[model samples]
Target: MSKYVIGDIHGGFKALLQVLKKVAIENEDQLIFLGDYVDGWSESPQVIDFLIDLNKKYNCIFLRGNHDALLCDYLKNGNYTEEWFIHGGKSTLDAYKTLDSVTITQHIQFLENLKDYHLDNFNRLFIHAGFTNIKGIEFEYFKPLFYWDRTLWELALAFDNNLKVSDNNYPNRLKLYNEIYIGHTPVTRINKTIPVNKACIWNLDTGAAFSGPLTIMNIDTKEFWQSDPLPQLYPNENGRN
Candidate 1:
């Protein structure tokens, strides 16, 4: 059985389905999603519904994202900020307009139950964003950092490639895992539309919320698949651009 990690979907249900079709996933395969399943596109609520159903039939691990957290808070308390609304939240709100209260509550439960981070048997770490404890994720005092921090990725990007884990100056956080898989910061920002490896950190968010395609990668083989850009999938919408 293979283990696949998906990047930020950003409410592109069509893009998510397209990539999954490319993967031709099997029942034995594990699907680990890096969250941001909602927001950006016009089908945010549908994306959540699909994920809820998908998990019942497949091995799926859904992690919490900053957007997901914000959405959850909005759903639970009906509170929203101008920043949240502009950052794809408005689209998500529009998508949920047709859903009944029962379905909305179910979606809220799904969002509330999402994991902050997942550590696998092989010492691979999967998180929506990054964590900051110098010791490790478990030692992280601020739980929100698991899905809100960017310093870890920033550190990886700036790290000297020559620095080994055994080196005295190596970042302690990078040494905590054999590999770190994250999706909050899209690689498209660096002009890359594919999964990027820097040090031991791998960024899988290929900017589905913007101009790039949705992506999925096999953790073991590093084999990946991508769908057409979100704009191409939803011809009329601007997504989060």
Candidate 2:
């Protein structure tokens, strides 16, 4: 069976479908989404429902993203605070409010149940928002990773390969666990730079909901697929991506 990894969906359900079509998913194949399945785009509900359905229908792995975490918090706390909402949490709440409380709660739990990261014995890892101590899973770091400054990663990228991420909030490269597949940091395109793996790490988030493009890459085959957003499909998330 072939293994696949998709970039951040960011609620671009339609675009996601298009990319899936290009990949021509096979029944024997397994697909893993790096996260950001909801939020940013207007189709948060559609994306969540699609993911839930896909997991039941096929072999798939979904990682929890910062946006997904905010959704869980909102469901339990109903605190639509500014910091979270400003990062696409507002749009998620708007879409969720349209559904009944029961369905919303179910979706929240589904999203929350997603692990902060996924790792296989075969030198592969799936993560969202770049974890500092990627040697293992750390759900507590999700918040900081989500709201973290990209400058940290940028600095890490610039320094020597031996650098490591410090526990005291200092930016050092802790040597990412495996060939990590992470999202949350938006890019103009499917840009990739592996500080340790000699280009094995892939940053697939092509910024679809940010008006850039949706990205999907087969981890085993190194095949790249992309689809641009439908016109105005993402006017808001377009800000940072």
Candidate 3:
């Protein structure tokens, strides 16, 4: 069975569908979605619905992203923040506007139940973002960093760029896994339109929340597929910008 890891979809339901169609996943194949399933586009509810349906047919692992956490927090406690609403949350809110209370509650449960990270038998780690302050694969506080930290990606990029002179000496957090797959930091931020590999960390978020395409990668072969750019798919939307 093939193992696949998909990047942040950010409510781009159509793009997600296109990428899935391109991959042509089978029943035996497993899919690991790297979170940020809601926000950005106009179909956040539909995205969650699709994922729920997908879980019925295949083995699916969904990680919680910062956006997802914010949404869940709002759903649970009605804690609304301006920052959350501005940064793609508005789109997500708009998407959920038509759903009934029961459906919204169910979606909240789905988001709340998402895992923060997943580790496989192959020594590959899948996380929505990255984790710092961990001891031997166990986190020592700083749990929110798993879905909110940018420093880990910065470190990986620094090492990749040869900016750090000591290549062999990595921080303890980076050493925990043989290969780490992350999605919070979009590769497009580095002017890359494709998945980026640096210091054994693979960044799968190709910025579907912005202008880039949604990406899906084969864990074993390192082969990948991408959807059309977000701007191309949804012509009028600014998409979390």
Candidate 4:
């Protein structure tokens, strides 16, 4: 069975469907989604519904993204921040308007149950975002970093560029896993439209929340597939901008 890791979807349901079809995932395959499944495009509810159904048919691991957490917070506490609304949360709220209470509750339950990170038997670590202080598989008490940290990716890039070095010859976090896969920070910020690999960390979020395509990678083979650029999929929208 093959193992696949998908980047942040960010409510691009059409893009998500295209990438899944491109991959042609089998029942035996393990699909790991790095989260940000909602809050960018016009179909946040549809994306969540499809994912719930997908979990019933496939071995899927869903990680919780910062956006997903913001959704949860809004659902449970009626707390809506301007920052959250600006960052595609408005679209998500609009999507839920047509759904009934039962469906919305189910979606909330699904989001609430998502894992923060996943560790495979192959020593690969899958997380929505990178961690800071980690001891083996255990991260520090700062839970928000699980879905909002950018410094970890910066450190990886710094190390890759030889800007940072250690006497032990490897970053402490990199030593814990054979490889680490993450999403959350789009690769486009670094001026790339594809996955970026620095040190032992592979960033899979190809900026589908904005202008790039969603990416899926075969973990073992390192083969990958990407959807058409998101702007092309939904030309009328500016996607979180």
Candidate 5:
């Protein structure tokens, strides 16, 4: 029973399917999606439907990314900020011709169940984004844990709740798990920079939304697999999106 941790699939269903095919994934295999399941690409609605179907057929663990959070807010509150729409929510709305009230409610419920962190094989942890600098209950909090920035990751590894009057940014000094895998930050290019790791934390966002490869890392063998480079919509020509 091999478990594959996938990178962000932000409405790039075609690229995701191609990557799964390339991996020759089996029914028994378990897959954990890091997050950003919708938005960015032109097929947000279809991507969500496909993922729902996949859940019925295979073992899949879905986590909540920042984009997913925005969609949830829009559906529940009837309005979301311009930032979400600008960051690929428009294409997501374009996917559905007309979703009934029941459908809308169900989709939001599904998204709500997604966790901010998942411990694979009870050893490997998966999160949409990074964790906060605080420990104890705050470290496990979903919002900050799923949307942390570089500064947070650095701080998370630096301080332990109560700061001693004298403390420095000691990344290597902090760790409580074997490995933590995450997505949300595009990796500049296909297989670019390898896996971003800070001791136990591992960043696996392979930039699929930016037309980069969809990555699948095998936990048992400590090996990696990738799909062909997908098309990018960004005009800057920069690798990371």
Candidate 6:
């Protein structure tokens, strides 16, 4: 069975559907969803519902994202900062208004249970963001880095193309895993709307929360599929753009 790594969804349910259909996923396939599942477009609640149902039908690994953590905090404590509200949280809160208490509770539970990262048998690491510890994830002092750090991505981006893995100067973090797949920071920031490879890290977030499409890639083949841009699919609503 094939294993596919999905990018950040960010409430683009229509875009999410489009990419999944384009991928033609099978029941036997394993789907690893890097987070930011909610907080962008108008369908944050719907996205969570669909993911919950989808998990029942397939093998799925869900990673926590910074936005997801913020949403979880608000859901549990009814506390939200202005930063969270302005950064797509308003749309997410609005989406949840129609849900009943039971549904809200279920959504909270789902969000709380999301994994910070997933390490595959092949030593490929899937995380929402990045870890800073030179030794690796297990030794990371700050757990939130799994869903919030940008340094790892920046380091990868700044890596010298001429450097070999065997070089002593190669970043220690890049050598921790065979491959590291992450979301959280959109590749669109670098002017591309496709998954990008830097060093041994694969950044799958193609800016689904903004103008770029949601993406899904086969971990083994590097083959990928994308939806139409979120702005096109959700023209009526300005998603986190």
Q: Judging by lDDT against the true structure, name the best candidate.
A: 6
lDDT for each residue of candidate 1 in 1-241, tens digit (9 for 90 to 100) = 9999999999999999999999878998999999899889999988898999999989999999999999999999998899989999999988888889999999999999999999999999999999888999999999999999999999999999888778999999988899999999988889999999998999999999999999999999999999998899999999999
Cα lDDT of model 5 overall? Answer: 0.69
lDDT, candidates in the order shown: 0.94, 0.67, 0.88, 0.89, 0.69, 0.94
Off by over 4 Å in 6: none
TM-score between candidate 6 and the true structure: 0.98
Cα lDDT tens digits for candidate 3, 110-177: 99899989999988999988876747337548788889988888888876444343456556666678
Q: Which model is ahead, 3 or 5, in terms of lDDT?
A: 3
Candidate 5 regions off by >4 Å? 134-142, 152-169, 189-194, 232-241
Q: Which TM-score value belongs to model 1? A: 0.98
User: Residue 236 CA error for candidate 2 (Å)?
Assistant: 10
Please, what are the lDDT tens digits per residue for candidate 4 over residues 55-124? 9999999999999999988877788999889999999988877889899899889989999899889889
Model 4 CA RMSD to the hidden true structure, in angstroms: 1.7
Please report how far candidate 2 places residue 198 from its true position, in Å: 7.2
Task: Write candidate 6's Cα lDDT for 1-241 as tens digits.
Answer: 9999999999999998998888878899999999999999999998999999999999999999999999999999998999889889999999888889999999999999999999999999999999999999999999999999999999999999898879989889988899999999999999999999998999999999999999999999999999999999998998896
lDDT of candidate 4 vs native?
Answer: 0.89
Against the true structure, candidate 5 reaches a TM-score of: 0.80
Q: Record all residue pairs in model 1 with backbone atoms less than 3 Å apart, i.e. clashing.
A: none
Model 5 error, position 125 (Å):
1.5
Q: Estimate each model's TM-score.
A: 0.98, 0.79, 0.94, 0.95, 0.80, 0.98
Q: Which residue runs does candidate 3 get wrong by more than 4 Å?
A: 134-137, 160-168
10 residues in a row with least lDDT, candidate 4: 160-169
For model 6, what is the error of residue 195's alpha carbon versus the real structure, in angstroms, after optimal superposition?
A: 0.5
Q: Model 3 TM-score?
A: 0.94
lDDT ranking, high to low: 6, 1, 4, 3, 5, 2
lDDT of 5 by residue, 1-241 (tens): 8888888878777767777777767899898888888887776666777888899999999888888888888778767667776777777665543777777777888888887778655766677777654452235544655654454445444445564424564443245456777777775633463455545566777777776767778866767777666564333322224
